[model samples]
Target: MANIIAVVWDFDKTLVDGYMQDPIFEEYNVESKEFWKEVNSLPDKYMKEQGVLVNPDTVYLNQFIRYAKNGTFKGLTNKKLFEFGKKLKFYKGIPDIFEKTKKLIEEDSKYKEYDIKVEHYIVSTGMTQVIKGSSVMPYVEHVWGCELIEGEDKDGAPCISEIGYTIDNTSKTRALFEINKGVHSGDSREGVNANTKIPEEFRRVHFINMVYVADGPSDIPAFSVLNKNGGATFAIYPKGDLRALSQVEQMRVEGRINMYAEADYSEGTMAYMWICNKITEFADRIRKEERDKIAKYAGSQGPKHLVD
Candidate 1:
């Protein structure tokens, strides 16, 4: 039995109150609203002008690179992105919830016996460096997100010249399988893509042992993946934001998520309660499975004689 329980997260509005890049826009004195407007138009603009198709989820990175190259976001490097992470404002009960939920598994003696524990992973479309620098980085087991490669500008100043990696909404499911198979984690394991024949029960983290949390429409692909695979799913909406609330409610109505809550993860909040309960539930099931397996596979006591 895979004794590890995984909690996967999507980082943008799911955790923070706003986009992580807002700090960058602030630092550059650019109108973030207008920048996003252009970003939203890039896919169709490219198709009409350059006969090209682009990923709507990540084409914004290209715009970022363009601005960096043009001196608008002068000397923008991964290091700067890391520094920007400190400026992020997370939702209520953030890293606190992360720590508290993880401790639930530790509270049970059976969980300790089976080495069952919870691990937190962030799979995002945002910059990885920023997340690595966030307050919650210490609690996070791993992060999968967009990346940038640093190179010199014409003046030899450091800048982000190229995109290194990207995890779009759809590709986010690949990160799910990676966590399922223990890729890029402490365990030395193959990519989920490398071995197509691995049985579900044999994966490093089974789907039943996972819980995924995120906020909006961009999370549909990931939510679908977990929902169909027996994993738990949750959605978050900002408080008093009826549009955000309605979005998640519709998703719940459509059976895309097991639950939805406001974006507060602090103690006594809905987000905290639901996530912690799910972790406890998974741990309970895993404890049962491990104990049952030991009895079933321990080789039948060599034909026991009735002594009683």
Candidate 2:
């Protein structure tokens, strides 16, 4: 048992509401819904016009999937993309969740025995800088999300040259590989750390503790991955978001999530309370098992061996 070494989070709709709602898209005279509809409608012709050289099915399918799932766009220069990122906002009580989760990680006795260290990470397909500039940045360990190609303008602020669209389950796994354990993309397996191997870890421990909270279909892949890996995932449906609720139900039906609950951040809110309870239960189980192990080991030792 170990104090939670890391806690990963999904940005955009999870920690914040309406980031992908895209007011700027609306401001730019493109309704996101209309844009998605148009993109889906023009698959073959659009791919041909863009001169996309990749697998046509992959490109076209991902065009719609990315837009619907993660709100990605094509042909946008990184500068304009980052500019759009700068304007996003968060949901109510988000700041408090960080402050409180941090405090609990530090002060809770059950977690303390695990030498639990808490690291907040955002796995998002949204803009990195958008998350970086938010109030939550100071609390998180690292952000793995869409990055802009780094180029400076006349004012010396980094401009977005291209959106990497670098957050999702697969990318999240890659981030865990590269950042946490220095595994590079396409690197030989020989170079990787054994501890970071997810499959091996799952096999060794009947219960590997993790908690993931996410908002919508975009999070399904991530939730599914975490849940399948012997971790718990909570699907959150924010108030006023019927779409999120619908997605939650679908995820439940697919057996893709561990739990589904409303997205609320008040100390007494269902989401907050449920997460706290789950963390507490995991911490308690690990702590009790660790104590029993220690006691058993102590009892197995020869008494006063030095006296002999």
Would you list the clashing residue pairs of candidate 1? 93-266
Please provide, for model 2 over 116-208, each residue's C-alpha lDDT reduced to its tens digit, 9 standing for 90 to 100: 545556777666666676678778766777655544433444433333455544556555433344232122244565255545432222224
Clashing pairs in 2: 3-114, 3-116, 78-160, 78-161, 79-160
Model 2 RMSD vs true structure: 6.5
lDDT over C-alpha atoms for residue 140 of model 2: 78
Task: Quote each prediction's TM-score.
Answer: 0.94, 0.72
Off by over 4 Å in 2: 20-44, 48-87, 151-158, 163-165, 176-207, 303-308
lDDT of 1 by residue, 115-219 (tens): 898899999999999999899998898899999998867677889999999999999998888888777778736544524557777788898889999998889
Best by lDDT: 1
Candidate 1 Cα errors over 4 Å, as ranges: 190-196, 297-299, 304-308
| Angstrom error at residue 72, model 1 | 0.8
Cα error of candidate 2 at position 23, Å: 6.0
